[model samples]
Structures are given as C-alpha cells and as structure tokens.
Target: MTRARLKLNTKQIRARQRAGAVRGLHKAVNHLHERSTAVAPIEETTLINSAVASVDEGALRAAVSYDTVYAVRQHEELTWRHDPGRQAKYLEGPLVEESAMMLELIRAQIRRSLR
Candidate 1:
C-alpha cells in the first residue's frame, strides 16, 4: 500500500477500536450496577422506614432545619456562582409562598395526629 493509504487505514482502525472499547466498558459498568442494587420488594419496607426515621419531627423541628438549608443555598450561590438547575428562582419566589401554604397543611396534620 502507498504510505498515505496505509496511514488512513491505521487511523480508521484506531477509531473503530476506541469505539468498541467504550461500548464494552459501558456494558460492564451497567451489568455491575444492575447486579449490585437489586433487592426483593419486601426490602423496600425497611428502606422506607429508614427514610422516615431521617425526617420524622414536629414543626418547630422543621423550622430549625431551615438554617442548614439556608446555609447550603447560600454556599451554592456564592461558591458555585451558578445554580445547579437555575432552580433558585423557583425556591426564592413561588416555592417560598407554596412552602408557607404547605406548613399550614402540615400543622393541621400535626394537630389531627395529636388528638
């Protein structure tokens, strides 16, 4: 083969091999992830119980929790200098009003639970 033709063929082979290697790597990663994260449906009950334990608390408890949230939001804005989802507008505006509405709903639930 001429030198130019040989170089072209080598470049084409290298590209094909790189593409195949990437596909193989993706398949291996997906297979391991699927195998490791699977569990029986009943295991979901314990998963939910753990999640509830993480959040079960009264309104005063929730209001105090806001401090951590505020700090995280501040850090994200100043340090990151960009919103991850540009979601700050939602949170700073309508979400605040919606949250107050939700708090009223939560207080009603707490009162009913106490009775």
Candidate 2:
C-alpha cells in the first residue's frame, strides 16, 4: 500500500489564522457595540456614536471604548429615567455575559481559515 503525503505551508496557514482571528474579533466588537447601544440610555446619540473597538494582536486583547466625556457618569448613575443620574449598564454587563461567545467566534474564524 502506498502512503499519500500532504503538503502544508505553515507560514500561509499562520497568516490565515491571524487574519481570521482579527476578523472574528472585529465582528465580536461590533456585536458588543450594537448590544451596548440597544441597552444604553440615549439622549442625543452621542454615546451610541462614540462606541469604538480596538484590537491588539500582540497582546491578544480587544476593547470597546465609550468615548464620550459623560460615559462614566452615565454608566455609574444610580437612577433610571427619573433622576438626573440615570444608571445605565451598557458596556460591562454585556461584555461579561458574551465573553465566551467572543472566544467561540475567534475559534470559528481560525477553523474557517484552516479550511
């Protein structure tokens, strides 16, 4: 019986994996942004528009920034729709809940790239 040999370019495979991971990170970030916006208390759309995502490949890290000046205030507020300080848990809650899904997304991307 003859054995079949398969050729694999390790460099190309690594590159594709990296690209796939980045793409997956981007998608996850966008999903987080959308979820944050949907749950956020909106006044003039500033916060919604301020939602931004960044990925650091070297560090293997991803983050979403609510760039508005009032982001902290809004998030930390104690009241909702009644008092001046409206407590809106926009970013943190969703991120924590969906963290596992983000990992799965990255894995899926890597799998696709390998294929």
Candidate 3:
C-alpha cells in the first residue's frame, strides 16, 4: 500500500516568482548597463558613468539609463563620431544584442527561486 498527497501554495509560489523575476530583471539590466558602458561614447566619462539599472517592483518593469544631457544625442546622432570603437546606440545596441541572454538570466533566477 502507498499513499501520496500534494499541496500547493499558489500565493507563496507567486510571491517567489515575483521576487525571482525582480531579482533576475535587476541582474539583467545591470549587465546591460555594463555592456552599454563599455561601448558608450566617452568624453568626460559622465555619460558612461551615469548608467543606472532599475527595476520597478510595483509595475514589474525594468530600465537601464544613462542620466546625461547628451545621452540621447550621443545615441541618436549618427553623424557624431568617437574614438576607435565607440559610437551611437550604445545602450540600444547592447540591449538588442543581449535580449536573449537577458531573458535567460531571468529564467535562470526564476528556476533557482523555485528550488
């Protein structure tokens, strides 16, 4: 004879998932920020250093930003030139290129949280 029972606390699971997602998103955004920094146009270095990665827990949203007056211009102004290996769309380029890895980061965190 054998007996088996299962009980699932969905509320707890959801909380775990939410926490995991937030953590994962934070990590992903930070990585993106770092990647962007590596490629961001550098003068006084403010643009590259202003990089910030944030996750809104309430909205379950995330963003990576460069808080500089010239950030948008530097990113959008295709006419502009930089030294050696730096150019426009630093943030956008890395984000687009690494989106899959970002998702994987989130997934990995969620999987870890479940265990």
Instruction: Write down the worst ten-residue block by lDDT for model 3.
Output: 78-87
Against the true structure, candidate 1 has what lDDT?
Answer: 0.34
> Please, what are the lDDT tens digits per residue for candidate 2 over residues 1-115?
9999999889998899888888888778877877777777678878878888888877667888888888898887757562243237778878888889877888898899888
Which residues of candidate 1, in runs, are more than 4 Å off?
A: 1-8, 39-115
* RMSD after Cα superposition, model 3: 1.3
Using TM-score as the measure, what is the rank order of every candidate, best first?
A: 3, 2, 1
Comparison by lDDT, 1 against 3, better one? 3
Please give the RMSD to the true structure for each candidate, in Å.
Answer: 24.4, 3.2, 1.3
Against the true structure, candidate 2 has what lDDT?
0.79
Candidate 3 residue runs with Cα over 4 Å from true position: 1-3
The TM-score between candidate 3 and the true structure equals 0.93
Q: Write the per-residue lDDT of candidate 1 for residues 1-115, one digit (tens) a residue.
A: 6565433566766555544444443333333323222221122233212211112122122211112324334323533343233232322333343455544544454444333
TM-scores, all candidates, are 0.29, 0.78, 0.93
Candidate scoring better on TM-score of 2 and 3: 3
List clashing residue pairs in candidate 3: none
In angstroms, the error of model 2 at 63 is 2.0
Residue 17 displacement (Å), model 1: 0.2
